[model samples]
Target: MSTEERPPKRPRNDYGSSDASGPPALQRSTDYWFDDGNIILQVESTQFRLAKSVLAMHSSVFRDMFSLPLPQDEPLVDGCPVVILCGDRSEDWTHLLAAVFPLQLFRTRNPTLDQLSAILRLSKKYDIPLPRSDCVRRLKCEFPTTLAEHDQLDTGWMHIEIPGDLSITQALVHLVNLAREVGLFSILPLLLYDIIIAAEPGENDHDNPNVLHHALRKLSTADEIACLRFHVRLMQPYHQTPLKWIESVPCVECTAAPKCSVKIDLLLGLALNAPNALIHEFLTQWDSHDDWSSKVCEKCLIVAKAVHETARQKFWDRLPSFFELPEWEELRKMDFE
Candidate 1:
């Protein structure tokens, strides 16, 4: 056998030549490429060209790692060093870098769940305070811990435009997972309530009816029970307690108040069949021209709405208790800053 031709050597970076046993160096991503970048961060096989100074300024971890004296034995490429970051996905690094880089990679702050998850995970791991804090702020803005915070949200059902392609359920599920991941426990009760609203038993869209089911399955048994308990409270008929107020409210529009009470009783009974009905859902129907409140006098409608609001607030104030969480005031007083 004649002598076999040896393959040419690959380019070496500050890290070293790629291990023969490992995969070859990945192609540099066009998205994150910086022509004047001083260093290449290699995560898995993928390469990210970035400024060491910027990274060091934002991350204590990076500062310490970069401060270590370089060995003469280390490899170099294109007069730049290669820093191999093991145990991280290139996809995550891409999102993390996008958040830090001066250039706006994406047009909006509304990052997808995957993007948020990756950014949060890497930012925490790298001890990059800004990205970590940014992620939490964005999440908290979307899933407020208190009713006041919830009402202050600029976009409500009237402005139900979500930032990205995600549905309300998907966004809520993402928040639930993110809150759990980052130990933002205070937001869980509200998030779970939103998820329950989406997972209404029978009338939910078949396209992804089980999104809540799948998300709930990830919870501990106690948490699951807490969610179910809250759902039960939400769906429980208030015919005897609150619905009876309809009969008590004086209405001149009808001569037969007792018969009108029967009609209101029947209308409120509809909630018993609706597993996902919220106070607002029933109130909206009642206020509409087609429901029992429509037949009642304007005074009756006003009283009914006021009573409904009070009842809804009472239920809301007790939400944390249903989930075995601390009081809302306690959650509000605890500062993350």
Candidate 2:
């Protein structure tokens, strides 16, 4: 049998080798060499495109600006297409409100609560934004019974996009805490608490939305009614009520809380000057009634005095007392140094 001379070593597909444009490690299955031989690899459509644009225009001006380009492959869309990262759904009232964007990633149109929740699950699994409209519409309509399974907080319309730095879980906890204090119902807060408890031993990476969802579902069986009652009672200590007050009052542009309000200065003073011991103690038991006057020196007291005088107190009281303090906030801030 004349061994058919192995079809002239089938001239290698141009994609088999790395070039300036192609990622060396793209799964060989998807790799293909174009006739022009300009190697290009697909990455997540949006970010990779963004990166490519930036690279084509500004790469030379800024040394190593786009060192690691994101993969630009067609999004995997079986049950739902999942992207692989999120920017913590940062917010501004004038900008896209935080709650609305994530669900749009799954579908450009409406999504129900369940679909939104499923999208969130996919976001956690693959590390993408939960902004898909399909996901949100799905979640809102289904009210995702599965959401109760996540460890991340679902306070209001919030979610844990990232895990650690402004994570979805943190957002959920904040929403729950805010709701508890603001009276949006413990439904969200209780949901967060259940998940926080449930995400046991899982790294607080904020990167893992699946684990976050897994923990949150524990709320389905939780005593939410009781927790709501407790929070209702808890509100009395501050003489404040629900978010309805703020919601009812249009969040109009008010120069009242300017970015550099004097309170911020006081906080900076505290961070730079206060005794670390005092700062640490205050944050450790922020909710407790430990008197700052007892630990803080006269200098910190001066900052505290300024802090008490600012309009920031209203917003401050909403957060934990330790966080409310200028010294604590100042110290905690990344730009403090």
Candidate 3:
């Protein structure tokens, strides 16, 4: 009688169990639910039915997990034990599984940024060496330690061949976070410099719409601060070394002092007025306009190129320091290890 209106009894299912307390319904993955699979890997509401032996062969973590004795009352679907993968995304699992079981055996394919990222994360988590090593190798190819390899990159800094919907700016932001997550510190200086250059108002505006705003919103606060600091700290070396020719008088063997002096002044103006001057590779010869080579005397041109090369090498050597990273050799060692 004193039973106040019991909260409307929770709805019951066909089995007469309350819906609120019953197990959540799972959706079998369309691609990964194999008829002969021996294990169910559930992430959230989706389940992947895969071969335990295959997974164990590839991943030490999985091998060890499978070696453990299961409880007598362990949940089973289609006679296979269910292993819920906590703190993992179904999409990431799909990527890793797809890589594990390729449609064409040994056929090389370049993964999109999203696919690569998912594979990298999951492979690292499960201690799958092959995929992890391949991902690291690809990343190093894109963001190499040596300046020579870097110089070979004609496409701008975010040139990792991300083939999909992900824009360059988005890929850059993702790569910045991913590199840190995976301990690829060697690539950060160049990557951060690219981000800083992209965030500069004019450089990123027309080509990459809203890049500045996107980067500001997406980048970690520490990375943002690092970029700001690098921008400020780089100015002294940027001006003093790479662009130091701006302050110098013409060469002693001056063939045309007035003309060479005027050219140097013009070069100085261009360097100063550049939107991303702090990160600009001033030593790089502009293919479209070699004004220094065309306008300056041969002797002066030779001297300028030499000075720029030496200065830029010094700048490159010190690049990792700007971002508070270890030297290039140390960073490279970390990557290999």
Candidate 2 lDDT score relative to the true structure: 0.32
Give the candidate number with the greatest TM-score: 3
Please, what are the lDDT tens digits per residue for candidate 3 over residues 1-337? 3559557654423323335656655688999999999999988668899999999999999999999999997767789998989999988888788888888877555777877888888888888888777778878778777777877776643423575676666777889899888777787877877776656656446677555566756788888777778766656544565766545448888788999898778777776666365455543543324655786887787776677777778878987887788899988778632
Can you give the lDDT of residue 60 in candidate 2?
40
- Number of the top lDDT candidate: 3
- Candidate 2, residue 168: Cα displacement in angstroms equals 8.3
Can you write out model 1's per-residue Cα lDDT over 36-151, one digit (the tens) per residue?
A: 88888988877888888998999999899999998896776567788888899999998888788747655544665677788778877788888778767766677666555665
User: What ranking of all candidate models by lDDT puts the best one first?
Assistant: 3, 1, 2
lDDT of 2 by residue, 1-337 (tens): 3559545442322434545664343322112222332223233222111223322342242224334553565333322222333432211110221233233545343433233344344333333332333333332232222222322323344432323445444444444443333222313423433433334334354476466345344333333344433333433421132211211111233233333234444543554453221212211222232443333444444444344333233432333221222232332332100
lDDT against the true structure, per candidate, is 0.67, 0.32, 0.74
lDDT of 1 at 303: 70
Q: Give the range where candidate 1 is weakest over 10 consecutive residues by summed lDDT.
A: 279-288
- Which lDDT value does model 1 have at 2? 31
Candidate 3 Cα outliers beyond 4 Å, as residue runs: 1-24, 106-109, 156-166, 203-214, 235-238, 247-249, 275-278, 282-289
